[model samples]
Target: MNEFLLIFRRDFTTAADQPSAESLQQHYRAWKEWFENLAAQDRLVGPTKRWDGAGKVVRNAKDVTDGPYADIKESIGGMLIIKANDYDEAAEVAKDCPIFAFGGNVEIRKALS
Candidate 1:
């Protein structure tokens, strides 16, 4: 099997406009369940990493700027590596990602050794 990286993207600007606490809990539960399922299937390669939606971008050897290209509609929220047979399979696996619930998306890419 090959390793694939699932890069989750979402609009962080609206993160503060989240639903009620109960709704947030439900979302968290869904995410937990998804990760648990991946672990149970022995597909998860490592722990998911969440981003704070704030960072700097290195443009050159010295030039730097604020990250996630502020002008963009979305930014990378998190990422997870998983084992899969191929790109198609990996994409299929990402289809059920919880990010979709918030109008986000997962960018599936094969990991290079």
Candidate 2:
């Protein structure tokens, strides 16, 4: 199986853009269930951890900056590593991601060995 990196992207730059607490809880549960299913199938290489919206960008030496990704409508929310036969398989796996319910998307890329 080939390893693929699934990049989860979403928008949470402003309070108005944030979901309600109830919705957030629902999404969290969906994520947990989805991950558990993947794990059970031995498809998850690493579910990894969620990314914080509050962060910084390091361009180069002495060129770091904050990155709520203020310039973009959406920013990376988290990432997961999974095993798949190919890009088509990886995409099929990502199609059920909880991100889509919230108008978010996943970017699947083959991990270079």
Candidate 3:
């Protein structure tokens, strides 16, 4: 089995506007359930949701302090590191991504060993 890094990218502002607090709680619950199922099946390496304010891109040796970059239209929301049999299996795992409900995108990349 090969392990792939599932990078979840979404328009932060768009997803933020789609759900109320209660709806968001439902989504969180669903997200947790999905992760738990994956864990039970031994398919997840780990899942991670990053803080939006932690982005930093350094160019050359100079520390350019622009910002954390969450203001961008296509900021990376979070990621899942999953162990799967193949890319097809990985795609199936990503099918339940919460961002998809908001028309967001998920990118799956094969990790270099």
| Best-performing candidate as measured by TM-score | 2
lDDT of 2 by residue, 1-113 (tens): 99999999987657877789999999999999999989988999954698887887776677778885657888999999999999999999999999998889999999888
lDDT of 3 by residue, 1-113 (tens): 78899887666565445678887798788778888888898988755565463567666878665555634776676788888888999999899877787567889987777
Looking at candidate 3, the ten consecutive residues that score lowest on lDDT are 46-55
Evaluated at residue 110, the lDDT of candidate 1 is 90
Give candidate 1's error at residue 51 in angstroms.
1.9
Q: What is the lDDT of every predicted structure here?
A: 0.87, 0.89, 0.76
How does candidate 3 fare on TM-score? 0.80
Give RMSD (Å) of candidate 1 vs. truth.
Answer: 1.9
Candidates in order: C-alpha RMSD to true structure: 1.9, 1.6, 2.6
Model 1 segments beyond 4 Å from truth? 14-17
lDDT of 3: 0.76
User: Candidate 1, residues 1-113: lDDT per residue as tens digits?
Assistant: 99998999977576575668898799889999999999999999977767788887776679788886666878898899999999989989999899998878999989787
- Which stretches of model 3 miss by more than 4 angstroms? 14-18, 47-50, 67-72
C-alpha positional error of residue 103 in candidate 1 after TM-score superposition, expressed in Å = 0.1
Residue pairs of candidate 3 with colliding backbone atoms: none
